[model samples]
Target: MVEPPMAEKDTATMKPVGTTDPVGITVVVPSYNQGRFIDETLRSLLDQDYPNLEILVMDGGSTDDTVERLRAYGDRIQWVSEKDDGQTDAIAKGFARATKPWITWLNSDDVQCDRALWRVAETVAADPAVEVVVGGAHYMDADGSNPRPYPTIDVGPGADVRREVFEKGYMAQPSIFFRRDLYERVGGLDRALNFCMDYDLWARFAASGARFGKVDADISGNRWYETTKTAGQTLDLYAEILATQHRIFGAVSPYFVQAVSDHLYGRFHSKFYGDRGHLFFRWLYFKALWTVINARAPWYCVKGLFCQTIAKSGPIAGDRMTFKDWRDGFKAFLRHGREVRP
Candidate 1:
């Protein structure tokens, strides 16, 4: 594997000026052609007041100025810009090099909330048994305006995480913090998965009997953009999510099918099909959804369908929406065929 040379560790920027504290956390950022958001992403981490932190940046060598931009940090960050495998591979490489007990990987285009590390550290410090910590998240534009709270599932140590994750699919990666031991136990990420790799890892962790914890506050900012992986690879993401679901359940459950059908994105996809779907194809699509929901999930899994699968406020202008507008959007969504990224 090709590797870029490292710089002398910049103790002044990463640590708390000689304050004695635990080697609490390490964050790995993997990037390629993400120079625009890279600065904000680094600043979010550097601005944290936590005592001990070691951040590593693994770049999949961009043709852009990503390396030069990172060098501007002047050793505050330890980074290597070189051509390597895909995003998951870069992150898995980062995991191999990280030494801190707590580990999490942030995308180059994303940033954390103010002092996000402090909150995460406290949660982990309080409960050593908590292998994974999940906090809330927000969706902001590239310009960083119009912040909105993203509702996530509230799960605890004893919850049925495997079932919920398979059915609801609410585990957000940005706001999650996990221990190093757990990562090793679950065998880290599956590099083969382009999308939904985090979900796959989480399912494996649950399957390995790892307990989860929840933080009741927003810990990071997940920037929403047209170019982000999830946005550009919606169809692939759906397939990966289903693949993960099937891997855990041994078969695609009705609950899972219903979960997909009742989703806003799936609904839009359904409409997208309705506009262009051949008669037989349309029949197959609805029949597949209906067959699964009625056979395996209608009575059992869909009771909580409205809980996470569908947004309560509706997808467009979530609040202040009328039934007629909802009706029209549902119909027009198919006619106009707006692009949906998970």
Candidate 2:
């Protein structure tokens, strides 16, 4: 495995991590200017009852009180505040230093759900074959009303990793953990990608045939404040998702056909984004619609058009239906022998 490179190096003393208790899981937190929430994030990690857990935080030279705030934790956490390349670089640096067999990373603004690490550890302990463990998450935004359950695709026996990841959407970053071997095999997160880096990594791991487990529980509290990395980059997010998948799966792979099929199903099932994506999205939608149409799969482009029409009638375009409405529609879409299993 290549040493996770540090894009830049500076003279910054590493935090004096207190004596660890035979660490089994190491979570590398990559943070920058997230002082408002970093304390809570650290608390969630420290408060985990899982004894053999270690916290390695990599800060990209936070100008805020992030360092001062973390200082209160004393030697409890192993940390370094320095000038690094970026979030991905900081993560790579921390990952290289991690000695735990199982590893995960949490951004500074995110908080681990109640007993999240414990649940992850429990699941992985029970089934060593399950290389990646993922759970649902509570997406919270201060401006938005309240936190809501962001459903994750069920990845397990007989699951299609490509379709679920590339098409189904909604994989919680904070709620995921994988073995170190998988990390080393895939070469960790790609430093070149600013957006969709996690998606790219997941795609490669899936292609590598890594086993997956869904915890079926909410394991992360992901904040979506104004300054969050996700807030901007809407265009880049959409473009990179397809580009990364294409780079690996090829432009004409049948997997992409399934992706379009899945997207169309979502369109009818209240999952489509109306007139808000790149032109290629429309082209893909048409092709996928043709596939379902020719197969007589009881799913058609017209149905989604009708649904979109209804959506635009009352509220407006681009507004999502309530979770209940979307779930109801999805059940109908799954009726045509396309249901995915957990």
Candidate 3:
């Protein structure tokens, strides 16, 4: 497949700075009817204490108390509460109005970690060539409690960002900070995608040969609940992600296919053998065999199943598991002839 053009620095927008100088960052927050959570989200950024920062809230004309909450912020944040197409549209509007050199977006339901902005700024300021800064995040429950580390793989030195993003999908939207010029250069977020716009943007950023830096700390808290878009529309999300893979690489990655297959198996198992404890492993084995037969590469699929079962290297969206953990779980599953939970 033909590769996209390389990213070039925008000299007109690039400003020289000292090592000690703070880098300006624009954070775009897209919201709709998230009155209960938006306040905390706004407060997280406001409390960052980063010397140079801009917080813009783009509300998609929420009918709830969201507008009142935005008004409560007063001049602390730049906001526009009006009708917009959707979350992607609101983010586009906010990005268009951004004056800072570095930019990122946080959903109204999510909150940035303490001093997260400082970590991002310091990384960017230390290396002027770094166009993207990727940090870690935590999965918070609906009540914003029990925060667990979100699996964020470090794109190490000389690692291919495009390959990692395309194959493993290893970045979190809330934990990402990138340069405004680099974003504009990569053509920004795709308007057509309702679910995987951030993933598509990362793929484009990687394809453009943009340099990336890692912040080895949790930068944001991504709240997870049944009502959330990600939790509710998981199948649709995977469909969008697969479509994005095809669009970027002209072929779907086997790792992504394995992830899709695993998701399908889980749904099937839940529907057919969820309550029937005896038939769990039987259905799993049957599904595995069927998946191998239908997969584009049968051997690759079999190997993936083994590695996923052992090394736990299928997808980065979920918590990673080690070989020893998987081996112990497998032993228990075999001994009881039932499904095992890790």
Candidate 4:
């Protein structure tokens, strides 16, 4: 595997493009009615210690005070207010107007620290070969003081990078930066997808042989308490994302189908199956899981769902297991290292 780009560790003296600082980065913030938080978002970006940078805001026809807040920024941001598809579409439009080489986006409710841009710029400038640079991301609810560490993933160049991404989406959107070339190569964000567009874009990039670099520094502040669509319309958005994934990948794509199946079981089980799906429905759930896996890959399905059989024997009616049965079996295997041999 080729070595990924290395970023600067110390406060090295390097000249930034269009400035005497160090590096140039374009920060994009996409907003849709996040009125309460848009001011803070803009303030955070403007307060960045990085000297040479452009902040762009793309609004998707927000009806509330979001447009007013954006207007307050005036020429500070290369601002564009218009009707667009959704968050992903708004981001794509912002990227089209980006003039800088390094790019990253923060949600309207999210805020980057004053030094976040400077830290990211230093990292990217340290290594010329690094195609993508990602840093640590933490969650902030309302205020900026409290922080909760979020998972940060780095997919460096390798033969298995695509396989890993296709199997599991490991990176978060807010904590990422990469070259405009890489974005263009991966075909930018999918405008049709309201949510999970970032997932699809990352998968496409990884599949196309782009290398990822990691910085131990924190570069993003994610706000989880916002009324984001992922919080209100998870199931529907996931369904749309799954359909899009099938079209982009194939019907049998492991990542696409497995995620959809897991989500279906998760949402339904939590809503109805007993305390978490109903005892009777549990058996049907496993049977349905078996059916799905079998339809996708028979041998693989049988091997993976074998545990469902033992955990659902009490409420078993047919040749399948219930939701609780499958849950218990999976839990046992995960916690006790006990596998159901079939």
The candidate scoring highest on lDDT is 3
For every model shown, the clashing-pair count is: 0, 0, 0, 9
Runs in model 1 lying further than 4 Å from the true structure: 1-23, 253-287, 290-342
- Model 4 TM-score is 0.73
Over the stretch 152-177, how does candidate 3's per-residue lDDT look in tens digits? 75576888788888767767789999
lDDT of 2 by residue, 1-342 (tens): 111112222235321133212227899999888888888888888876455678998998899999998788888998999999888888888889998888889988788876786677557656767889888898888533489887677696688876676545458888988888899998888887887788788878777888888777888888876667766655456557656755765432233343344445455533543333222333345455444433432343444434322221121224334445545544554553354444
Q: lDDT (CA) for every model shown?
A: 0.70, 0.67, 0.76, 0.66
Q: What is the lDDT of residue 79 in candidate 2?
A: 91
Question: Which candidate, 1 or 4, has the higher TM-score?
Answer: 1
The per-residue C-alpha lDDT of model 1 at residue 233 equals 72
Worst lDDT run of 10 residues, candidate 4, spans 1-10
Which is the leading candidate under TM-score?
3
User: What does the lDDT come to for candidate 3?
Assistant: 0.76
lDDT of 3 at 166: 71
Rank the models by TM-score, top first: 3, 1, 4, 2
Per-residue lDDT of 1-342 in model 4, one digit per residue for the tens? 111123332345433323334556787889887899888888887775455678898988889988888777778887778998778888888999898888878888887763666666656666668887767878776666678887654454343666656544556577778888889887898787777787778777776778777677666787765565677776776577556545554433334344445556557664553243233344445456556644555666555555434233322123344455557655644543333243
What TM-score does prediction 2 earn?
0.69
Once fitted onto the true fold, the runs of candidate 4 whose alpha carbons sit more than 4 angstroms away are 1-21, 142-146, 154-160, 244-273, 276-287, 293-342
